[model samples]
Target: MALAEPFEIARGVQTESETVIVELTHEGMTGVGAAAPSAHYGETTATVEAVLPRLFEVLPEDPHEIDAAHTAMDRVVNDNPAAKAAVDIAMHDLVAKLHNLPLYRYLGLDATETPTSSFTVGLAETGEMARKAEAAVEAGYEILKVKLGTDRDVEIIETLAETVPDARLRVDANEAWTPKEAIRTCRALDGLVEFVEQPVPAEHPTGMARVTEQSPLPIAADESLVAPADVPAVAEIADVANVKLMKCGGIRPAIATFHAARAHGLETMLGCMIESNASIAAGVQLAPLLDYADLDGSLLLADGADPFDGPPVPALDPTGVVGTGARRN
Candidate 1:
């Protein structure tokens, strides 16, 4: 039997309130994965819940048959990203368990002892953001992603730069600006930030391209590159593409999107919605091939949720460097 459930994470302002958990059982081995729906993309808990029944109807008795599983998932991509991701992850987990290997190994990543991940400093008062940046740096985070697009964006970045002079900084506007505003903001924060992500809406790829060509810092596409179809357009305008399991629909499409980004010379960033470790662990499988990773959602949660409940797997160290182990840096 396949069991699916829901969860919520309280991320202020960017409150990610919905998640879907799926467990697939076959031959007494259970495979599990979690997914979250983004309201920004017209997905919700209800949408994922509505699709779970249909997914169960098509799941085959043999979980090891990857082709059959993929076919079943392809049939459900139209419903919602969260639902699709949940089902896809469950299948991947099943396959990994069948081989007695970690999920990252199945995805072709070398297991490392630790991989350093960035800590996010959400939108807040300039002083508050600066304090958070200082605290995060003190806590051993080498990279910081700042949420922007507010009236005080300049102040936020400026204060953060002042607080953490040596830390690498990036900003995500979530497509909250007009082309003119995006250009202006990018120019203003040019030297202060390493990269500015999805400043303009996805529909304005040409404008983003124009911004990328003129801006001092690199530009990354987040909401702009949701599928393989979006790759060409986003590549033309951006230097990087942020691939989220939720937004890309699932693991297969996320991999497809990564290849598409590589084909276009656009760097790939393996990102995630505000989700639990279950989803983040599943996403770590694609990390080795990515240029930047923002899979620290699990760390950001106030309550701990361990996706991999068994032995602790080696991951990247806090310095953004991969640790020595069976995993590669």
Candidate 2:
């Protein structure tokens, strides 16, 4: 799918990408899933397509072998979280549909307790970012996650905060800044933003800590926490943790990391790569555990062929997401 608007980060820019989508049918109960392989994580559509053939072999008709299918794929491959998430989410959808329950109900989460997700305002020229920020709020987003680290980071946030003062604004540098730049940037936009995410690169754990210490707003780690194994390190360093299913494999590991973050007294945000309804449905299943949410991938895509429809799954107001995880038309 093509991004309705360009999606840019410190690493590069994206306008379109080929994502892998899957359909796992059992007893005629078809479960759908989408996997958006991220170049940042060193994954490509070809790689995801290559790894998924193994699912047909190992996904026996246990019906509820969600964990087993994910595990089987992991044993065969090392680190294609997005690819594994495709099978992981389809199995979850299958389990829920087979039980005649919504995926959230199947997971036993209270729908009322799920937090509204934040809409993203991808990095752009200052004027364009302001317009997108305003548009997202007008579209019913209470929370907004703005991409930062450009020379105009301050200008962009200042413009957005001015445009939507009451709307909650958050900033992500996407590992673009240095320790000093992060601290200075956060200090400049302290009250303007709710938090600063991944202020520096994960490799610079020392820089992260220093930025965390100096920044007034809470500091969140995204690049630092990919797998559950990386949790302890991020927990020790940042005040908040961002968990993306694409980055961590799938639902089970994401939940494990969410609980792990809670145990470490860190705030959790369940985020996602730009995707379609299938994976967004799986990501939002853990909403009860998240302190923040950014599952706005499908909403960013450009048309009818995008394969996402309606609230909750595609969420009319992702900020007020509430529903089931089947293919909602």
Candidate 3:
């Protein structure tokens, strides 16, 4: 799908996110999923497509048995987490549809307990970012997640806070700052943002620890927390851990990471890459278990081409439940 506008972050700029949509069919029923490939994770559309035959080999004969399906997916591939996530979501969607329940409710979650997903604004000039901030607030977004990790981080934050003073704001540095730099930046951005995300490189937990210990604002770990096992190490320094479905493999692993992070005394944040509603919907299903959410990838997509005939871009209901999953037409 095309982006409503080009999205820029510390990493780069893009006008669109390309995703592979998948369909799982059985017994006169069908389930759908989408995969957003990431070069950071060493994944691409061609790579994801290459793994499909292996995924098909382990296709769950019984979609209702989600656990078995998930395990089968885990066994099918070693590093194609996004591809595994697509198959995982499709299996879960199929099960939920068969049970005639929404995906979150089918998983026994309290839909009312979920938090609203944050609308993200990628990095840009101070004036440009503020304009995007204004548009997001006008469109009913109560919380805004901004991309930082640039020299103008503080300036951008100050301008955006002034532009939408009432709207809650958060910033993701994406591992751009040094230990000392992170501390200084965090101190400067103290009241401007709710928290600072990945202010230091993922490779330096000690730097993150130093910033977390000295900074006034809470620090959230995005790059550092990749799996359930990776949670405890980062939780030692970070206050919040950001869980992305694409990053952690899929729903089952994401749930595991959330619990693990909580066990280590870290709050949870549900986030996503530039993704379609297929993956965004799966993340929405898990939002009830998180303290924060940045699952607005689909909202940035000019079109999701959502084959499921559901609301692809979420409404940012800070108080209500958002629906998810796909069905056969």
- Model 2 lDDT tens row, 291-327: 8888888888887647655345323222233323536
Residue-by-residue lDDT tens digits, candidate 3, 252-293:
889999899999999999899888777777777776788998
TM-score of each predicted structure versus truth: 0.86, 0.93, 0.93
Backbone clashes for every candidate come to 13, 2, 0
lDDT of 3: 0.81
Candidate 2: 10-residue stretch with minimal lDDT: 314-323
Candidate models: Cα lDDT each:
0.72, 0.81, 0.81
- Candidate 1 C-alpha lDDT tens digits along 18-102: 5677888877777777768887778888888887888778877776665576677667656477787887887877777776776
Q: What lDDT does candidate 3 reach at residue 301?
A: 65
RMSD over all Cα atoms, model 1: 5.7
Which regions in candidate 1 have their CA more than 4 angstroms from the true location? 1-16, 111-115, 304-329
Determine the backbone clash count of candidate 3: 0
Distance from true location, Cα of 270 in model 1, Å: 1.0
